[model samples]
Target: MLPSTYLPSVNRLAPPSDPSLEERYGSLHIRLLYHFEHDFYHHTKSLHPGLKDMLALFMNVGFATPYLMDELLAYSAAHKSILGQQTSQLYLSEATRLQTRALTLYNSASPQISKDTCLPMFLFSSLLSQHVIYNVSSNVHNGLGPILDGLTNSTIIHRGLVAIAKASWPMFSEQVQQQLIRSCQRDYMPIPSSADSRGECEVLLSRLNATDMKPESIAVLRSAVENLQDRFDAICTDSSHAMWAAVQDWLVAIPAGYLELLNQRRPEALVVLSHFAVLLYRVAEQWFVGDLGIRLIRLINSHLGPAWEDWLEWPNRATMEQL
Candidate 1:
């Protein structure tokens, strides 16, 4: 956990020619910038080719906007945390403050959204969402379903992306527009064949012989699992920057009734969610999901143990195979 000390705004203001203040302010940005470019940027570049262009645009926007720069620093700091650096906790605390300041600026702005602020807002939202996902995924001891609270941040990111696309598409240069299109194109993909998923789900569902189970509840969970399978296929096929956004939306995208049943701790719901855990396994190579899939399955087993072992047979087998 990061300490609550406040970092002064020495850097956010114009240089006062005070050597110490300048050094303190300038060094933070310089260090974070180096980390972003040389370390974080290169690692994420392969996530999507068009992300390279988006990052360039983000840098241009960040340099001009102090609040946005704060967000960028925070994001880079969070990225460093993901890399297992020892100084990450301090950086994480500062990242929280910086993100708060950026949001404060946006909220206090005039009613009419300015074109000047649009780019920063969009990039900040996107980067913040990425930071939250990466942060939560890397800290698995906190668990999965609860970590999904970060989805609200992701929702803001998606809305910001949509707003920018609708309002500013015509304003950017042809080169930038082409890059944006390529980035957007990578987000959506055809759903893959469902034969394997269906087979897997059927095998898992067949283990449930509890006569006391509600048929409607079972149906809802079944649908949810099937929906997760579809999403998993879509994510596997997608080669876009938007893929992470979709992954974040997974919880909300499923039927609400399905989630509610899970809240009730329906055994069938747990079984299906276990399979959703498997989807996480399939995408574990993606930094955004990381080892979360394996952890989620383990957590599920811990919660629903030997008594529910029959329901977990397929999921446990799948998880073991992944190991």
Candidate 2:
């Protein structure tokens, strides 16, 4: 574990009650801001360099934005809660409190994505993405239904951040946009793995195509499968691409209509999703991912039952081996 100390420039950081910040959100928040940046910020950065660096460039240098700051604290606290800290309950309570407040503030804002708000909103959504996954996946006492629901929720959030990124992409300068695009495409979503999933994907596609679903539905699902294949190929062939980046990108890339298939509990859709669990399995050690890949595999397998056991064979085996 990294020490909870600030970098050399800690002296320049504003005191918790800096008049301007205190004026906006009071001394408690001012203290929370200082404590987070002073203690946890550097520590957290060491844990996820890509995440910390990205947010540092986008949000940290400025006075903490209300919602984003809450989320950062919430995420850090949630992580602490799981670390067997002596005050884990307090951290957990604070995590939940801050997370709720952050979401409320975010949802209450204007609907439109504007130049000024877009990047901040995007960063907020991005942090919230991992927060939800970490929060949901970490609490597993409820059984399969809640786990499935949590994953479904993560997928929904994944789609949302994708929308925000697409809308905000054009706002950057060509050079900066290219850099940001690389971040969004790779560092921004570290969910997939470079593990060989071609066999599983092929089975998924074969089963998908044989189904009697509507042409459009089949087409949508097929596009998603092909997208997976292309990504796996890229991961295998390209040295620059992060293998795990492909994990969440599938959820991000899939169209809304295809998600309806998952909502409807379509066997093919479930099967396709189960294959994505392979990506999760590949990166199961990641802090936010954990055993989620295995959980997703079990949920889908149990949900589909014997009828689709053959379809789930690879994903099921991949995750089960971890046990």
List model 2 lDDT by residue over 88-183, tens digit each.
787777677677666655555533667667667777777777777776676655665566556666766677777777777787557656556545
Write down the lDDT of every candidate, Cα atoms only.
Answer: 0.61, 0.63
Give the number of the best model, judged by TM-score.
Answer: 2
* lDDT digits (tens) for residues 14-130 of candidate 1: 122222212224587688888877777688777766776777787888888766777788787766765666776877665665556554454444223345555565566566556
RMSD each, Å: 7.6, 9.5
Between which residue pairs do clashes occur in model 2?
A: 191-247, 192-244, 192-247
Summing lDDT over every window of 10 consecutive residues in candidate 1, give the lowest-scoring window.
1-10
Please list the residue runs of candidate 2 whose C-alpha ends up more than 4 Å from where it truly belongs after superposition.
1-52, 58-64, 85-89, 170-197, 212-216, 237-243
lDDT of 1: 0.61
